[model samples]
Target: MESTMTGNASGKKKEIHVGLCGAGIGGVFAAIAIARAGAKVTVLEAADHLGEIGAGIQMTPNVARLLRKYGVDKVIGDNLVRFEELNLRRKDGTPVGYTQTSRIEGALDQPWWLVHRHHLHQGLVTVARQHGCNLMIGSRVVEIDYLESNEVTVRTEAGETHVFDLLIGSDGINSVVRRTLFPAVKPRPPTTNCAYRAIVPYEQIRHDPIASTLIQKLTMEVWMSEKAYIISYPISAGTDFNMVLSHHRPHPVSTVEDISMADLRAEYATFDPRIQRIVDMIPNAQRWPLLVTGPLPSWSSPRGNVVLMGDAAHSMTNHMAQGAATSMEDGAFLSVVLREVLAARIALPDAIRLYERERMPKAFRKQQVSFLNGAIWQLPEGEAQRARDRAMEPELRGEPLLRSPNLYGDPATVLEVYGYDAEAHAERALQEWYNGQDWRKDEGTGIEAPVAEKVMNWFLPEKEKFVSKI
Candidate 1:
């Protein structure tokens, strides 16, 4: 590993050495940002190789903003599928509501993206490597000795030990790092649902009449019913169609385990024929038990040098699809904090405290709303479900409102959730600490065309980027 990870290296003694456990979205995002901010970061990933298992994930405007600014968006390029529309339907395949995504994207000055989880992970890792961040694959943290030394000593499962000025646990929900940091705090109860994510290659079904026609829609079509919802969309640059089948379970499963195709078919036997056909084509899927965690007393060590990010700190359901984005936000916010501390603009303790204080409330909102979103989708088949369907009328006509039944159609909620900028928030936090001038007065006031929008407009004059309104 290089001695420095920045455009400018002093070629002298290092200022700070940061260690990160897990190279998932949050850890890698932090690695890139922190390295770019002028620090050395060593990533220890437990996996034998670097990759993502899940097939599909969505990135709202808030995450898109960070990626675009850091050039990760460009790196992913055409693999990114900009959602043009989202359709809500009943279990019988009856249309309930429809909303255009461009309106929200335009309002936020960022694009809504759907892509293979591997693509997103690869982009982040590429950028992190480019920034000179050292990646130690197959190194899983087994022990931490922060109590005895000024620096943290992390021994991996393989018995190799490494030292760092700061240790960040960006590992997922079952984080060993988080356990060491907060010994006795119990994890939140698991959600009463499990999600089976599967991808069907379009090439395999291009000859089938029903499947081929539906696969080319390029929109997220969600089918809702009592206690379950199925979300499907194109991923892997439209070569694969991704499906997320979430259903209510009386008791949560113990862990992510292999799911049988016949068992999955039985679970969704009551669904529409189209859904059944897709499930039949799925070669494999893992049943993932959704979990909610944290709002713990804190996410840092007593010494404030060892910290938790991503699922290590907070894990929520996928109802809102903000799980991964929130993880990335942790790293993005920390980048700003570390930048100030490295430049001597803020004290390390105060900066860390600012991160803990400011991020807690924001994270709380996400955790709660994620549960709320699940409730709305999992409404029982009754008058209440009908009433919810009626509330989606405005969005069905393409006019999203402040409080639409379709949460994504509600502009206010979209802005509140997707318009968040962690880096900007970190900036604001520092200004408040010093009672400095406001730098965000002009931000969020105007919409500038993103690079994709500009090129898309020029290349495909016939293809309108946004339809109707902003």
Candidate 2:
């Protein structure tokens, strides 16, 4: 109901408040970035506590650079395993594709890092608090009353309601904000591919002869077959090994964290014996389906006061290892474009539009690429599999490639995808889009649309329909 100007070091700009749902890495980092850009951001998290979480994640150079920029690299320094090598192989260690992590650093100027999900999340939360971002732990956003008049009220499970100029839904694949706002639409159809994830102590493998050789401190090895694969890397300062066994199933599964090792072994029966041995060392595993979100026609609400972020925007599979990276990019890009709102160069809606136009295409591209790579990985042992193997020939032989089936082995992709600078990319796109734009803003307070457009929007009975459609 109230809008005013706030004077800061940058200049006198519109005082804006954002209600952010979900405090995962993406949400928290977005808070930090937005607060640094001089906005007031409140993060509503469902979890009561974000403690020493488990599992490991591969951080590509692109995201690794961002983490470093925020000093997160220093915070999670001791917990990282700088990847020295990446191997794509059959269960028996036959090479499907391989690359030295040095190549990533040599071309992208940043190291490939493997870290515990908790460490990364912790690092983001630390920086976010430092940036004056407010955190509401245990406050699950159950109702997002986003209206056509640019009014958004977020109600949590605890019955407290808060209003903000904007709402960002980084609430993850099963986002409450998304469900509350766009109740009819679904993220994706159920997925068939699921995975069993477990962490075994490094000492367990160290005592076993075969399993010990299968793992190394600075290596990530992925073992695959026609239908199943296993990804293993060290995490938590190399004290444990993170193992993910991807398997295909005929029916959908309800995800459970503590699945019996018997079920895991039975499912992965056809996988490499080495993988089986590694599975034997695991006491428990979690069966998590590789869920994906259908790409929204637009990542913003029709009014633009409310929007989606991270997996809330574009959830995908694990093939590209870019889910976190791309989500973080979403935050960094938002920080840049939203600054235009704070500076009065663009209204909030236009800023979101610009952010969507510039960022969504790339995010969608990553989604498709991730799905494609998963398909390539699951090809049965036949001509298709051979074709995939041949696709790796150029990179394996130390030669140049023109769009290899193996996305990771492509040098051009390595450069373009890994070396991407989010702020630079958004700035360039916005500059071009802003220059050609026809609308004007009243010093960022509001957009000055023609009378007809305003009247039409005012008359529309179902504005949420437009937002959902868009």
What TM-score would each prediction reach against the true structure?
0.88, 0.87
True lDDT of residue 358, candidate 2:
77
Clashes per model (N, Cα, C within 3 A): 0, 1
lDDT of 2 by residue, 2-29 (tens): 2232235556678799878989888888
lDDT of 1 by residue, 246-334 (tens): 88667776588786778887887777777767778888888887888878888888766888888888888888889899999999999
Residue 384 in candidate 1 has what lDDT? 81
Task: Please give the TM-score that candidate 1 achieves against the real structure.
Answer: 0.88
Model 1: residues with Cα > 4 Å off, grouped in runs = 1-14, 186-189, 436-470
Question: Which residue pairs show collisions in model 2?
Answer: 187-294
How much is the lDDT of residue 156 in candidate 1? 92
